[model samples]
Target: MTDQTKIRSGGRAARRAARAAPLPDHMRPVRAGLTGGAYRPLTADGMDRIHAAVLDALEQIGLADAPPSGVAYLTGAGASLGTDGRLRFPRTLIEDTIARANRSITLMGRDPAHDMELSGARVHYGTAGAAVHLVEVDGRTYRECGVQDLHDAARIADTLDNIHFLQRPMVCRDISDNLEMDLNTIYACCSGTTKHVGVSFTDPSYVAQAAEMLHMIAGGEDKWRARPFISNSNCFVVPPMKFATESCLVMEECIRHGIPVLLLSAGMAGATAPSTVAGAIVQALAECLAGLVYVNAVQPGHPAIFGTWPFGLDLRSGAMTGGSGEQALLTAGCAQMHKYYDLPGGAAAGIADSKLPDMQAGWEQMCSNVTAGLSGLNMVYEAAGMHASLLGFCHESLILGDDLIGQALRCVRGIEVTEETLALDQMRAVCMGGPGHYLGTEQTLGRMETDHVYPRLGDRTSPKEWSELGKPDLLAKATARKAEILSRRSAAAFDPALDKALRERFVIHLPR
Candidate 1:
């Protein structure tokens, strides 16, 4: 070959290599902290109406059944205790709490590279729930969730790029005691994934012990304090204006113990909350604001996620309709309230009403995932692997959900109309000086990976090509991916010695 021929061949080889190379952190089409808020489901006037309703509910109707300490702390901080034993927060108190609440917080992964900032329109998706059953893919059967299953889910989540964090998504039904269950839940998840983990405590006393275990995993208490990788997913309230006393106490203890809290207010609309979408949002906001006040009262500027997850219910059947358009609207609306208060908040999304990972599940997952990201939620829990309306989780479904989340997050990124992105030169070259087409071009090759998202399981081939490739099955691909991910042992950043000590000290159920 001539020297010119060698040079041209070398250029082609370089371009091909670049195309095959992994995308850099900055170039990845979808990442952990993409700004959203392009799709606003609620208008300014609607938000104002909800805000007024929320404040009115807090000041007039108030919340009854505060744990004694919650009552004392809230009342001491300008909330008035009525003769009916209800704790009424003044509008002024709610405003002040919103102002003082920690707005920007980083949920640090044990791997710092995975850390995500919780502020503004930055969105992060993760798995979370209390599903008692596991969706067994092979047999298409439902079995009780166990500690090992929780660990395996975390491991699977760690391998999936779209899943930003791992909250305890299942209850360890095999464990009989509440305290042991809570402790093992923390151990199993944190051991399996270095991403920020969230767990709940049945009682306040477990908070300190869980924190100690977290400190062990984090190298030391001081290190854990500086970059706490764990958060308490505390459901601090019941619907219809009542506080879940034990959960509220657990929230306070979590705050004191240097752990972040997801102050969850999950009221099922048409049952626990008002049937109207607006009314459900009003109830959720009122309750989360109460949580906000409680957190700020306990420790001003404490890190707490405004978790206003108001679920939708099928009024006719009295069953939870987690994947309905109504649920999507509810979550998106709650996200708006979070932004309105200028507080870091989240709601549930990506839950499948279907029993399995089927066509129905795909639609359900995407609709809510897209809407939640666009609504600019800071944290979106239950963003993957949930099915049967939060009653079961599927490992294969989690893998599939990651692909769905990638597409959803790309939507969240929206359109960038920059000069380079406008591609006038590329267009001109193709139309005028190029082969009457832009098939092989510098700009196209350069922007391919950065500008587009490719799915791992989703097929995009023509019929002939698909048939040539053995007509791949998406679920089978997902099942293979799940097996591959779980086959590899988890490599959480804790030292072996620390892991040994943790296992020795705690009632750890999951085998290493």
Candidate 2:
């Protein structure tokens, strides 16, 4: 080879080696729990107005249809029962509960290594939703999601570095019984991935049996209480100042069993909530604030996430618009409210209104995910795999979402300004007697891993090189990665004996 060709080859080899080298957890460009809070869609005055409106809604409008137990819980904690049978929280009572709420919480993974500390503006993204269908990898068809599909999604999430945790994403449509479905949902998620799992019980009566199953998994009630890896994603309120009676009962039961709770208040903008975004946010906050009071009333300082998930609506057709810019503004606005209260918060984002993982899906998912991350949402739920306004889940989209979220998190990390980063010295070196460029410098090599995030499936190849490699696109690459991940047994799989015991105890539909 000519000397010039040899030099080029050696330079390429060194750059490739640098890219291959791993950095420590702190040094990596992105990971779980990066601080957000940078994008404030709500101004300070706007947030205050929303807060005041929320307070008024809780105190004056109140909520109807609380279970008797919930009435006792709230009334005992200084709330009043009106002649109209509505439960009302006093302004002071709500403020006091916020004062006593848990400021920070460590969401423990079944494996300690995956624990995420949620506080301040710390942001983490993960999969969530009870999507009923699996958007087939073919990208055009759908089928009822069985227990095996849920397990496979968890297994896939376990392998992806950017997917921080796995919530029960899809319903086990094959399971007919509610009790069996709830138990098996927990079993499938826990057994598939050691990451923290979230599940919701269908009925309050199911909680006892589910607790027993959880105890069996944790070795005992004490161990489970000490490090409860699972959280109850309870929708305590329906919408527009009303309690979901059955869900309230379930939340109370889950709290008694020492499981953490997500106070989810999902209202549609034009349907359940007011059509205006501000009005929708106020209602969501009011509903979640009531839930916060309910949880703290049951047990003070209990780990409850302020889940204010208000979705957007296409007013023209009354359809849910999960990917609209209005939805992004709503989520971002809610996140600012969470920061105002200094509470750990979660909200929905990254959903695709599009039925397929096409270019439309890409833009839709990225818009919400980027906005959520930038606004510092603590638990950005549905941050992956959701399609058709959250009716379907896709493995290929989930894999693609890992790359998407990686880029979003880089935006969350933002630009760090410091002496070294200013690069005055490096600039001086380059302009003086140096290489006339920053590439291949000592600083460049050192910052490569720390300063930039690389995508696993996103293609960056040039036209000629892309043609050489058979011209791959994002979907093709994601399909291959998903297949490769599912081809092997998961490293996070449960122990054989434990799996056997769980299967024997519960009607688990997933195969061993």
Candidate 3:
């Protein structure tokens, strides 16, 4: 076997052994199917309102005043690498071409998606950074993760998927140490992925410190100044939320440094912005556009990722419930808006407000993720278990989310039609011969790989066979699969000196 394949196999085996013990019933993932479709498109008037908002943003806000490189990245947002040797931007087509191109670029082992890459995909397992507060395993709960946990998590994630970036755990249950908590979490949790890291810091010095660490990790000043692993300058603008001055300053620094910024807006229908879905979308668009304008005005050519994550408030309880129709609408709307600017867009998926994995969580996560995928979003965040979302994380939920994302990716492949799919010759052969010999034909063999949906966890065997194999349910199968993946833990190659340097530079404090 190839060295890479061997490493992967061994790593999976190792992870599986670590999680060999059966999961408790409360921790097992809940099984639930898709809910009935209930989507409503915006009306003509609503569309007009949205159009006006976009126009206002373009004219009034304009681009931020940034360096040449920043301008090249920003104004060139949707520009594609053309065969003619020139950059091409489609004014008429507002799609996630930039993000798609970025994804393609990153997959080729480069930093193309910029900051979005860090926010988009990658795996980091274990308790570390901010995650220390959120992860409860082996009779441990709410314990702050130190530096050791962060490296361990990074190592675990590294052993799994090619973790491209890192996110600080939901450390600091209260808001007091939000910045320190987030930075420490990010520093500990991510390594050997991409150099990029993210945090929603509202303190200028803290943002600078984070930026400095990012610079250090990227090798030196030259690499740091070049990109410095795109850090986000995130802020909330709508009611129930207020914009922070530090975030604004960080956005300026990001623009000056050519770092990509994401203008995030989170609002709840009926409570924060509007009562209807369309109104909420419009408000979200307005908020994001305003941030875009500010960023562009400061540094016109700065790279940016447009984002919207608005949900509905349970009017009776005034709680922000993530698994709601509003969440799906917001996700879809963000993709649509990205098309308008020909820019990459961001939306949250795989989140449930439920404290545990349940029918509510499953349906909510599935609908939102499917909507984002169908809308052709450039990047979808929170693609794993985010319970009481913006509140906690569940390991089983993350596994289930991985499954859901796989399905969504399959959906995005759309329907393919080819000569083999037509199968005219095969049909004729079957008709002439009789009953059902076509299953053994070459055409069937050729088409099976493409036409069939082979689920990784779902039951497809006959009842007798299934019973004989231990009568495992979908959840049980998923659990087993997750264990299998964890068992094969092999390390990825990295510069030992650099890894050691980063660890030495950043120190984590653990309370005794």
lDDT, candidate 2, equals 0.92
Locate the minimum summed-lDDT window of 10 residues in model 2.
15-24
Pitting candidate 2 against candidate 3, the one with the higher lDDT is 2
lDDT by residue for model 1 (1-512), tens: 99999999999899999889888889888899899888789999999999999999999999999999998889889999999998998889988888777879899988898898999989999999999999988899999999989888998998889999999899999999998999998888877898988888999988888888888877789999999988889889988899998889888999888999888999999999999999999999999899888988898888888989999999899999999999999999999888888889989999999999999999999999999999999899999999999999998999999999999999999999988899898888888867877767888777888989999889999999999999999889998998898777777735778878987898777775
Over 4 Å off, model 3: 1-40, 43-45, 53-169, 172-180, 192-197, 224-230, 236-242, 434-438, 450-453, 473-494, 509-512
lDDT per residue, candidate 3, 1-512, as tens digits?
A: 99999998887676556445544423322111111112224544656678675445433443333334333544455433334322223432223332232221111111443232212222111111123244443342435434444444343333322122444434444334656655654454444234244445655456666766666655666776665454463763533323344566666666565556767777778887777776677667656655554565466546566667677777888887677767777767666655544554566665677766667778887787777666666556665556665566555555565556556655554555788667787788789876667764556644444344445555679999999999986555655655664455323323567656655665534221
Each model's number of backbone clashes?
0, 0, 35
Q: How close is every model to the real structure, measured as TM-score?
A: 0.98, 0.96, 0.70
Off by over 4 Å in 2: 1-19
**Where is the poorest 10-residue window by lDDT in model 3?**
30-39
Cα error, candidate 2, residue 408 (Å): 0.2
TM-score of 3: 0.70
Pick the lDDT winner. Answer: 2
Indicate the TM-score of model 2: 0.96
Judged by lDDT relative to the true structure, which candidate is superior, 1 or 3?
A: 1
